[model samples]
Target: MRKARGCFIFFMIIIVIAAVIIFYFIGSNDRKIASDDSVKINYSEELASYKDNGIDYLFLGIDERENENKFEGRTDTMIIMHIGNNGKNALISIPRDTRVELEGHGINKINAAYVYGGVNMVVDEIYELTDIKIDKVMLANFSAFIKLVDALGGVTITVAEPLHDDKSGSDFDPGTHNFTGEQALAFSRCRATAKGDFDRMDRQKYLLAELFRQKANFSIIPQIPDILKILNEDTKSNFKTFDYIKVAFKMMINRDDFILLTLPGESATIDNVSYVIVDPDEAKIFLNENLG
Candidate 1:
């Protein structure tokens, strides 16, 4: 019996070691891509260069379940996370359905930029639409986002009201809810309320703040390997390694410093297509007021 027990213990140790090796390779933590302009190549490159102070970073969460390897997909969520040198941070959430005029494609939903020309076109359209100089971009798809959240054990959020959206698979009551990775993803996607996208924008900001708060915990160190791997495979960032680390640290420390705002626009249906007509000048004013 003693001999058998010893063999079983040795086998379990070997299995654990093997699993660690597999996850390490799968995560590709050391391998990271650095893009100067866009996530992909473009003939006409018009993009903002990386800056030091008051950097504006675009966080684009895309619906990339279709293409796993290419990092190309229609953006499901667009957030402008601005960090100023004065230790202040602001976040502006742009609805995916917001209408914009891409250079090649006249007028379409903002999310369509990725479908038309990948990240290059999408970044260009944002610059045109908001007139905001984006210093960096962080791109991730739904699957990778969920995986990172799950690897962190999950996040706790307070739901102000009961929400149930069959479209997004979100169902939760008013309370402090401990959401699994999948639940968190669904909550971020829910837009079936009377306010529709408006309510979703609020949820996204709330979730972002909550995630940052959760990340400040030192307990998350053990999960870093897995999370980094997921980020390497599922996300793309134009920021340098130091910049990424800097912003991450800032986010953790200044979660409450986030000034969450959404672009002001009225909804209109043109040619039976719903759209949000955003005036570039107005958006610029709003940013200056909130960010300046």
Candidate 2:
């Protein structure tokens, strides 16, 4: 009788392990980065040194206003976050309209990589431009952003001035307001100011930093089950178990360690098409200084 009971428990464990493997593979649909490529990045020394610190990941927020099994749209927002070992961090925002050569697709705006292919193609384009090796991909639809913010009980933000954007339903006074996930999206998407997309990017980074602050202030462990449930519903990722652990540890160390920055670029008309012509030299300096 004891032998039969032990066998039953072992069999159940195998079933559970199979389920988890399937879950991981479902999101691990892109492995093109490992394929033979001309682009070779030398992050060996840096990665070895930072092994005691944290890791790097590409956080892509696609412009899919709704969530479903099928997600297809431009990646409206792109940010690469590098979590360091000594409570130091760096975040670089890539402009959606930045010009880049999409694999198989002709040269176009960076965001369009998603429309042409998927996460793999986007990674390819980013690597070609930055020469940074992204360890993981967090592909999130706009709907997931809302769900995630709400799951954390909303985040607070200070509006600098009065603004109204009927297109995005973003109307606010010059004061601090606790914003829901949907309102947060609208707030970040508003472009009534003189800076236009640059202003929007700043707002996005501010909200993102606030989210980190709030997550740290309030214990997220108890809310993990609930928050993860919401995350799974609207998002997909290729993050491994240790990756999640490292991210949590980094955030716990110091949420404010994050340094927000953007690529230096100017608007230009190329063949009557608009693009943000990035200064490669400036970008290289920023990448080497911050990433190393």
Top candidate on TM-score is: 1
In model 1, which residue pairs have backbone atoms overlapping below 3 Å?
Answer: none
Clash counts per candidate, in order, are: 0, 1
> What CA RMSD would you report for each candidate?
6.0, 8.1
* Alpha carbon lDDT of each predicted model: 0.77, 0.73
- Among these predictions, the greatest lDDT belongs to 1
Query: Which 10 successive residues of model 2 have the least lDDT summed?
Result: 32-41
Give lDDT for model 2.
0.73
**TM-score to true structure, per model:** 0.83, 0.78
Model 2 vs. true fold: TM: 0.78
State the weakest 10-residue window (summed lDDT) of model 1.
Answer: 27-36
Instruction: For candidate 2, write residues 1-292 as lDDT tens digits.
Output: 9999999898777667655654553344233224413112334454434432355688888777533433567788899887765555877788888988776777899989877866666766666566655667777777788888887889999999887999878999999999999999999889888877778888888888888877864365445555555555555666654566667777766687788878778878899988888866777777767655
